[model samples]
Target: MPYTTSPVLPPGTLRRSPQPVLATGDGLVLRPWRIEDAPAVHAAFQDPLMHQWHLMASGSEAEAVGWVERWLTEWEGERIAQWTVADAHSGQLLGRVALRDIVLADGLAKIGYWTTAAARGRGVAVRATATLTRWAFDAIGFHRLELLHAGANEASCRVATKAGFALEGVKRSAFHHPDGWHDMHLHARVHGE
Candidate 1:
C-alpha cells in the first residue's frame, strides 16, 4: 500500500495524535522506541529463540542505530507506529510491536511483533498486540488489522490466534525471508466484528 501522511499542524496547537506510550495488562507497558533502546534491541536480536521464530539479518551496531532512527522518523510523521514493550515496574525493554503499512482511507494496517527470549511464554506479545489493536481501532479509527506470519513459525501463528485474530488464509510464497520465499498464514481482525 502507498504511504500517506496527515496535514501539518500549527505551532502550539494540539494535534490530537495518539499517545506515544500505552500501559498494557498487569506488568507490561508499550511505548515508543528511544535511542537508548539500541543496545537492548541488539541483544534481543541475538537471542537464539528469537532467531528461530523470526528472520534476523546480520547487522552491526551502526545498522541497528539506523533502524531505530528510521522508526523514530516514521513515528514523528504518523506514517507508522511502533511500540516497545517493557516491564511496567522496572521499565526494562522486552520487545517491540508495530502497526505499519497503514491505509487511513480504508482504516487498515498490518501488525508485526517480536519478543526477546527472556520475555517469551509470559504472554507479553499477546497482551501488547491486543492492547495495540484496540488502541488502533478505537483511537485511530482503524477498521481492520492484518497479521502475516511465516507458516513455519507456529509460535507467531499461535500469538495471532490468541490475540483474537481470525485466520484469513495461507498464501504460498507470500514472503521473502532470509532463507528464501516461504508460505505465510494471514490473519485479521475487524472493528466491531
Candidate 2:
C-alpha cells in the first residue's frame, strides 16, 4: 500500500508536553491527577452513580493510589490524558475529565467525565467537558472529539449536548454494564463545529 497522508498529529504531541492545567471560567480547574488525590479518588468511585455509568472502580485507597499512578503513567504513552477537575481556589476535588482512546493519526479521542456528589447540579461536569473540548480541539488540534454514554444516562447526554457535541447516533447493545447490556449514545463535535 502506498502511504501518502501524514498523521493528523505527530507522535509525542502529548507525551512531549506537560499535561496542562486548564481553567473553566466558572471556577473549575482541570489539571493532571496527583498521588495525593487518592483519598478523594477512592471516595468518588464509591458513588453509586460512578459505579452505574463507569466500569472502573476504586475499592480501596490503595487501589485509588494505583489508579492515580496509572493515570500519571499513561501520559508517557500519550494514549489517554486524564485530569482531576478541582475548585480553582480551594483545589477541592470537584470531578474528573479525560481525553481517552486517542488516535493521533485521525485527530480523534473520546471524552469522559464524572462529578462528585457535591459537584452535581453545579455545572461542574458541563464546564469541565466544555473546557476539555476546547483544549482538545484548539490546543491539541484534534479534528473530532466523541462523547459516548449508556443510552439511559440522560445526565451524560445533557452534558454532551451542553458541551456542544451533537448526537451522532446510538449503538444498540454496545456497552455491557454490571446488570446487562445497554445501548450507547454516540455524540461528537468536529473542530469547527
Highest TM-score: give the candidate number: 2
**Compared to the true structure, candidate 1 yields what TM-score?**
0.86
Q: Which candidate is the best by lDDT?
A: 2
- lDDT at 80 for candidate 2? 91
Candidate 2 TM-score over all chains jointly? 0.97
Candidate 1 positional error at 28, Å:
0.7
lDDT of each: 0.81, 0.92
Off by over 4 Å in 1: 1-19, 52-58
Candidate 2 at residue 139, lDDT?
87
- Give the clashing pairs for model 2: none
- List, residue by residue over 70-110, the lDDT tens digit for candidate 1: 77767645547788899999889889999888666567789
